[model samples]
Target: MRATFSRKAALLCSAALISATSVMAQDADIDSTNEDFALDEIVLKKSKREIQTETATSVTVVEQDEINDRQASTIAELVDSVPGVTIVNGASPQGSGINIRGFGANGTYGSDQKVLIQVDGASVGSEELYRISTQLFTDPALYKQVSVLRGLGGSFEYGSGAIGGVVLLETKDASDFTGGEVGFRFRQTLQGSTNGNGFASSSILAWQPTENFEVLGNFTYNKQSEQKDGDGNVIGNSAFELPSWAIKARGYFGQDREHSITLSHTDSQVQDRDVPYDSFGTTSDNFGNVDRDIDNSATVLTYNYDSLSSDLINLDVQYSYADQQIDQTYVPGSSPLEGGPSWPFLEPLVNSNHRYETSKFLVKNQMNFLTGGVSHDMRVGVEVSRRERLDASAAPGGTDDRLAVFVVDDIDFGNGLTITPGVRFEDQNIKGNGTYAGDYDNSAWMGGLSARYAFGSGFAVFGSAGYTESMPIIDDLGTPLFMTQSEKARNYELGFSFSNANVFSDADTLQLKATAYKTDIWDITSYSNADTVETKGLELEARYVHSTGFYTDMNANISRGEEFNAGVATDWRNSPADSLRLTLGKRFGETLDMSWEIVANAKMDRSTTPTPSFNAHNLRATYIPQEGAFKDTEFRFGIENLFDQTFTPHLSTRPAPGRTFKVSVAKTF
Candidate 1:
């Protein structure tokens, strides 16, 4: 049994952590660089890993510093290292999307809307279109933080049907550059990559003319050509021209800044020429390749009022409208569709388009109080949203109106035990127009329980049990194979964590977290007759940071899935191959830092066709010369896929990228 899992342990022993934030943040103002932290207290700072150790669920945070270090061409590549998370459809930005815990789609096929993606308190990615991905399609430079909360244990507040998890992206604020000072500042970054012959430019203008008002404007221009796999083969439909921009403003009023309002807008466009109909898969001879014009944009407004005299009266109100549109134009004389049972009714798809516009409003409040000798942290909220699909291709076109109310309470017993229970009630009306003009009403209650106990010895145990019902959208209701009923899922998890300070020195720390979970979903619906699916997985993360600026981090994920139908069991698409990712790095007194990474994926044992495994290596380094004339400049360099091993990732139709060199430089004034 140990031999079967020796690689998991071996991978852990060969891992490294990214721990340069502390060393970089510790410098005083006099010795600071362009990206310096103008703070008084530095020693009490905490790294990303340390903050993650305090969470019970499977959560990961990718901050701006790490984002700058990666210099990835796509968002898929930006968050590749997170455990139990897969960003599929890397071949094209328009087809890119996220799959967490086997809940999302690949290429363009999953109708299950289990994963929730939010940017600046606005939900953006959600759809079911033919040969089109409903996943995220945005540049990585727009956001300052990317947070993932995996599993149903922590997804109730976000929305219903988040059986996989939730991803939250917060964009950069004006304060990031102006530091809340009454002045103007500008920053620029330029990056280039060898694999795709790509270049990216980012410019930010921040102005804070008054303490009560601040605004930020950002513009990004990115272009990348087709890339080659390790075998030096060009991956077709991989090229894109993208230009994105964002404008954000925040206004503070009232005494002590008790009230604030924010308005932000962003737009991104990706245009690809003669790409495969299935951007993530092989080109269909019948349809061949086509030109794709994809646009994703969002506008969000937020208001907050936190009482100065009372900690019990805190409130937040937010409203957002986001749109995603994809337009495909077919080339002349590309190939004609062969005669089939549905040929007579099918018209030549000279042009096809799908657009989704969502408007959402939410109000939430939090209070901290004591009741019956138990300290209670309570949160209650309401969310109302309307999503409309316009002129969809072969899919339903209509609007879905939904209202959700939720409450979550975190109770601390003061005896080293904490229990959190949350619940949500959602009511939605799906209305279809045109051919499938019908309205359906659905409502359900869902929730979960999580508890953790700390032993005061740097060790803790936690567990969660959750159940949720998934409501079918208009696409599912109007498809040929219709589904009127909601799917039900029951999930359970058990985990433990250990965190120690001053492990070898007062400045060193070590942390480990492990989790085992199982999910049984009844009434599962798919294209075929498959139903009643069950899955289980194991996840582990370990990290160690030394006072000497050396650190190591590793994570492992293994999942197995099966579906039963007519007394026969078969492999489920939700089952993903096991993977292990490790990193090792050190900080040379904040002036220079380097890290090496390894990502190993196991074969798909249940795959009908043989799926091989592969390992990819990456090295990255950054330098910032302190106390020099060029102190306002920073440089970064990286080498991806160092060995150039040709292999395809499991569940992917295309081969991964080859060895690529990347470099970037940034300056602030």
Candidate 2:
């Protein structure tokens, strides 16, 4: 069955790509050089071409400079700076997880990992939530920018699993084709209470050919070793504390290379202590360790046609592949009560592997009735994706095959108001092998509508509503111990934004944006659990950029969520009642900058479940030296958990890292 599905998927993808290529070739009058031909202007909402300010959905774009200035090293760190996102760092780099708008369903506090991750334009995650590591994209030096879409309005463009939100990592590309940049960064960290020390260094180089065709690539490697201290010490008293390491590489090609291709790969390994069966009055004398690793690679190809002069068309094709592997072990110590009388405490060593491949074909057309004042922007596309899973145990291997086709239309009703409506149809088949046995066929249809009105200048109000669906991860469907059903969601949102120049003066300007959203989800797939949930929230962000050297900005978000069993209400598991974040920063002269950021998170105490605790406070400063080879060099230092507050972020199992100070230095050339 799997073989048959693979052949059919391949044929379908080839046909779509061939058809799109033919359309581009036949449109001889189209101008391939038109900037819009590159799809760079794609507003990213529903994969339609619309002005960013005119879209009803709330989207935030974070540039490379912002990431560098803020010293964000991981997606989790970066999302925390955004108004409505939260991250629970894993026991190590390999176990990290993200929670958006309280959608994580894992039963343990800070244990949920529902948030989905994507690179370029493809999804990357284990069927289970936090099971997938994101260390591959952790390097700040390789990316050009990141975009966060706050609701379901954009889920159509990327598919389901984005019920909470979507994080898109847009990598850097060489512009001139012949130029390249080289840079290096080094950082050191100290844990106040644990007396643990860590140091890391990274370097990156990118190059583009002077010709129209070009290739850009970057590589980063990081390693950190520390002693088991503080909360980590209490959990597992192993002599060799957990060690973290990661390596990443990416490449892009495009015409002098016009076609674009990308490859990204990452490897991560960590040792984590595990304690199972706490109620058995059995505390083991020996510690168990978990070893985890992941590797990912993706490639995308696009063709541009400038020779065609027809307004009837634009075309693009993309293909991507990802492979992930994980290995876990539980080593039993020599304890009479812990490993059983005959050292029977050892858990089975397990290894799992997953592979994913996707191919997409898309065509866009915009026509203006020059004489009729009627214009239409339309897009039609098709995609095929195949996934396979392998496990060391006798448990069944899993395979999923999906085929999807969609179309969207945007009509300008004049008066700065435009209405967009679209629909997508999908068919998926899931099959399990080995001890796990199950076969299911599913179909889904998604539709949405969005409208925008601009009030002259830089101000607009927009709203959108859509139905979205997400499939349960392979583990959730095929695992022996924790199998569950699939999941789907519906999202509604409305938002407004105002941006102006010369507001307080030509030297100062302010931009304000706010949004309110509600999400209803069913069969929500938790990492190793399942439940239904309803999430509602509001988000507000204000930015003030000054022509002068000083600027300040602030943003905040609050959300409410609840869990239900079958159809009845249950405790809100792993959900927070309220969360707020604020940032104030200023630039002093040309060489100095400082910022103070605060995060306050609160969860209503749930005696039924150990609710995550609340915490706040952080301060940072940056200095750039002037003159010489270090002219653009920058140094940053910051302290987190300023008060040394000790609290458990993932229920009572894992405690948040206590007070720590970090310093980093970087130079660009």
Candidate 3:
């Protein structure tokens, strides 16, 4: 009966294709849809809340629509196609950390986090090994947009220690569902996947009691069983459950609506049981199951004021608090000594727990004015944060304090050119308590310069160069010999962007971007201030869309990492392989749209270990009733891993799932 049900699901997808094309002839008669039309002129913001135009560094933006279309439940799934980004431990049930330019890639027991995660206005997790991945604990549905900055040169506005880059996530607001009017809205969604018979349910409520006041709330629950490989073998101990919730409130004051306040809170938790393993990916192959639980919670408050008369009064202030914890318990199983007598510690149940807590405050001001016929946009900001770590077992834990101030200016030459200059100063101090008492302090100065010039032929060139310094995190500090010179790096990059609205026809469009960069890191924190790292890479991205709703996208990268000791190149443990991703799909209609997509990834010659490549093909069919009781309801069905190919990703121990089906239904009232 199980086999028959699986076969019928596959046949239903094939039948959907046959029926969708027939209805497309009539559905095409509708007016042109403005969806996915923003192939150019994307806007971003810095930590100071200043607009970052095209002259700024390279960034990848993913919207909620795209996330829904791909059913990306985890951060790793959401960013797999982005250049210079790799997901380590791709098959683990407990989340995975990201590697940007080989910065957060190598570790046997513990390693410092080079890639930072900023949610709302606070950084939440710890870089220590055995800690939970920051991005994975939170539900992806809570975010409305996700942005990824490629290198250090573009990330000075945020706090230090982002040698790899920064990932900023923005949450949804009440106005998103209430349509800026006085009303109430409620939405409920149910989705499931066949990989491990996983199921999820989410509900959202929004209320706009007055023209200037609104509130929104969301709750979600997720559960899954053990997943199976292509050969129908269970990846043992890979079962989990998650519960998440959030609340947001916004208020607009002042007669001219110049002042606003927003407050939000989010909480999420995950519980799972799995086998214990170490660096080589097979340290405890014959051990028992390891039960684990992770929890993360945060709260943020923001105040904004826009002067009605002068730009000098434009201001923003925010405060936030966050806490994260991980708990693990190990239990022995039968034949625990299959390897040898070298393992005798698995006698009874062992338990451990760790926690990280942080608090932050920020204030910024922006001024736009003209000076001698040249326009200038200036911004100034200050930030302060305190972090604490806790351990119940024989591990390292401490507290740290950081303070920073920065200034930035964007000058327009009024000749299709812009110049941007920025500088920052940071002071960091570390303190240890509880039986271990010590102190360390460090300070540094960093700055960068960037420029962009647009030609008359739909092309533009941009480049940036800078020097940056970062202090060690809690885990990296607190050792007996505390030497703190701070990690420093020199970064450089060059890139170009091109866009054409009419590529082959009046309604067709094409966009392309290419970038190359080199960075050298001295006084490395992980290497105990001995070795230096040099990393270089080239990235390319292209997208084309036809009037018939057909589109193709491509992203590719070539990168390498090397360590230097006394100016001699050494084999680094975390060198990335050349990888490529290609995606092809078609949007059938506007009202009752159907999408068929194929996503594939390939790589060769991995520096750490040898591995095979993998590909996944997916199909999505969506239905919306135009005039019926279900007018506002949506239904979607899809299938993942169409070929059921058995393959493993680099640095992964288990194989990915095969031949999975998915279904979702959503209704709003």
How high is the CA lDDT of each candidate model? 0.77, 0.53, 0.69
TM-score computed on alpha carbons, candidate 3: 0.86
Candidate order, lDDT descending: 1, 3, 2
Lowest summed lDDT over 10 consecutive residues: which window, candidate 1? 27-36
lDDT of 1 by residue, 31-63 (tens): 111111222111222332433555567788888
Candidate achieving the largest TM-score: 1
**Candidate 1 lDDT:** 0.77
Residue range 1-669, candidate 3, lDDT tens digits: 112223244446434654655443221110011111222211110110111224447677777666666565566666666778877644333635667777664434323567777788778766566423444567777777778887876577776767778888777788988889999999888999989988888899999999899999999887778788778887644456778889999999996889999998888898765645332234444544557677889899999998898878789899999898877676545336634564444322234567888999989888899898777888889999999888445345788898999888888766657788989899988887665656888888998898877654446788988888877666755554433767788889898876545656656556677888898888776764247988888888777666676667777777877787777876455656667766666655445555555554566454546665566676767676766888868787878777877765554445677778888888888
**Candidate 2 Cα lDDT to native:** 0.53
> How much is 548 displaced in model 3, in angstroms?
2.4
For 1-669, candidate 2 gives per-residue lDDT tens digits of: 122223244446545654766232211111111111211111101100111343566777776556665554445566565666655543334335556676542322222334556666555555442223333324444456777776676656666556767777766654412343333223222221122354445444434333333344444444343333234444222112222222233343432333333343332233334423221112342323334333444444444332245555455555655554544443344224444553342333222233333333333333332335634677667778877777445234677778887777776655567677878887887777766668777788887888777664557787888887775545555442333345677888888877554567644455677888888877655522336777778888776655554556666777766677756775556554466666667666557777777776676564354555466677778788877767766777877667766665532234555566777777655
Pick the winner on TM-score between candidates 1 and 2: 1
Query: Which structure is stronger by lDDT: 2 or 3?
Result: 3
Kindly report which residue stretches of model 1 are placed more than 4 angstroms away from their true locations once superposed.
Answer: 1-51, 108-111, 336-350, 479-483
**Error of model 3, residue 32, in angstroms:** 22
Per-model TM against the reference: 0.91, 0.76, 0.86
